[model samples]
Every structure is written in C-alpha cells, then in structure tokens.
Target: MSNVELTNMCMIYDRTNNRVLVQERVKSWKGIAFPGGHVEDGESIVESTIREIKEETGLTISELEPCGIIYRFNDQTGDKYFVFNYRTETFSGELLEETDEGRVFWINREELLELKLSDGFKERLPMFFDRKFSEGFGTWNEHNISELKFR
Candidate 1:
C-alpha cells in the first residue's frame, strides 16, 4: 500500500453577500487561502472539516457540498497527499478575527483573484467554482517543483 496523508479544505460561502471566508495564514504554507487543516486519525473527513473550520473561523458549518479534490505525489518521499475540497453557504456562530492559523475574513468573490494567494491555491479555485472540473492532480519532482493539472 502506498503511504498517503489526508487533509481537507472548505470554502465557506455567503450567498447573500456574494463573498467567501478566507484565511491569511501566519503559519506554514502562509498566504490567502481557505480555512482547513489535517484530518486526525479515526476522524471522518467530513467531521474533520467541520472541526477545522470551527477551530479556525469560529463557525459551525453544515450542508457541505463536496466540490472537488486536489492530490499531490512527491517523487522523492514516495508519499501522496490528498485534500478533499468542499464548499458550504450554510453556517452559524460568531466569526473569528484571528487564530493560530491566520486572520479570517470575508471577501467578495471577484476580488479573491486579485490578492496574493498561497502556492498552488490559485489552481484549486476552478474546482470550487467551476462545475466542469472536479479534480486537481499534481506531481512533485525531487527538486520540489510541482506541475498541477485540473480535470
């Protein structure tokens, strides 16, 4: 069996405001991105997503719509990483201003592309908004350069 690491990310949308929740991460892999984190052992992917969002953004989210997935394989390490992507417009609770992960805020959908996004995050946008594509596959070389393609 191949070694794999599972993680998740969620795009919390506000339909009424035409915006989505974003995190400007202060930790590793910092930059503009969605709120999410690793799935703990024995936790379902969906459960982990809910927990991560709550911890990072202080919101209780539900009715998740599974949008797509992004997977990457590292040639040197022989490990594969998978990020199950989801989007939901249904959420409740007080929003957090900041967390150990980063600062959380809502931004207009159109303005998202204008900001400096985290590495590989720009390519993942289509999977969230474009129904035509449902997957992102990335291959990482020994040099750590990645080539990503969507389908």
Candidate 2:
C-alpha cells in the first residue's frame, strides 16, 4: 500500500510590477520556490494557502486564483503527492526577514527563469504566469519532469 499527501501551495505575483514572491530554500527543500507550504489536516485549500503565505512570507493573501496541481511520484517510496497551486496578486503586511522555510524576496518575471529552480517549478513556469484562466497538471520524479499539461 502507498500513501498520498495533499499540499496547498501558491505563487504570489504582483502583476502590476511583473514580480513574484519567491524563497531561496537553503535548508529544507534546497531550491527556489514560491511562497507556500503544506496544507494542515483540517484546513481547506484556500485557508492553507492563506496561512502558509503569512507564515512563510509574512504577507497575508487576499485573492487566490486556482491554477492547477502538481502530481509528484516517488519512485523509491512508491508514494504520490499532490500539490495544489494557486495564483494571487493581492496580499498585505511586510515581508519577513527570515522564515523557517528560507530567505524570501521578490524577483522580476524575466529574471526568474534564469535562477536555479526546483524541477517541478521549472517545468510548470508557464502555468504560473499564463494570462488566460486555466488549469494545469504535471508529473515529476526526483530529478526530472515526466509530463506537463495545461488547459
């Protein structure tokens, strides 16, 4: 038997300025990722997104647009994980100096592609910034991306 975990994650984008809130995860995940975290046991996806952004970036999320989900596969453990991604442009509060996750900062859209990003994040970059409202799905392994689909 295998166990699956559900995680709620989001990317905070300031559309007006063409920037995004990102974290250089130096400890745990060890890569550049958006500001978000796991969804608690009893929390809804929206609630988890809001709470996680606040905790990780010190910014309170106001609006969230459903983007899609990332389905990750662990070949060694036979475990599957689903990470729900959301897009938000509205938030409040000052950015944090440090977080349990890592150092946080806003990056310009063009420069984001040049940074070393997580495998899944790099594979799904289009979905994060696409203007048309839609959903996306992707499957990835530890070091490589298997497939990516968007609608």
The residue-level lDDT of candidate 1 at 21 comes to 94
Worst window of 10 by summed lDDT in candidate 1? 139-148
Which candidate number would show the highest TM-score if scored against the true structure?
A: 1
lDDT tens readout by residue for model 2, 1-151: 7778878778898888989888988765678988777778889989988998899889998779887776767666677777788888889899997787888999998899888886557867666777442545555566765665666
TM-scores, all models, native as reference: 0.95, 0.83
lDDT of every predicted structure (CA atoms): 0.91, 0.79
TM-score of 1: 0.95
Task: Looking at model 2, report the run of 10 residues with the lowest lDDT sum.
Answer: 131-140
Model 1 per-residue lDDT tens digits across residues 54-98: 999999999999998888998777889999999998999999999
Candidate 1 at residue 86, lDDT? Answer: 97
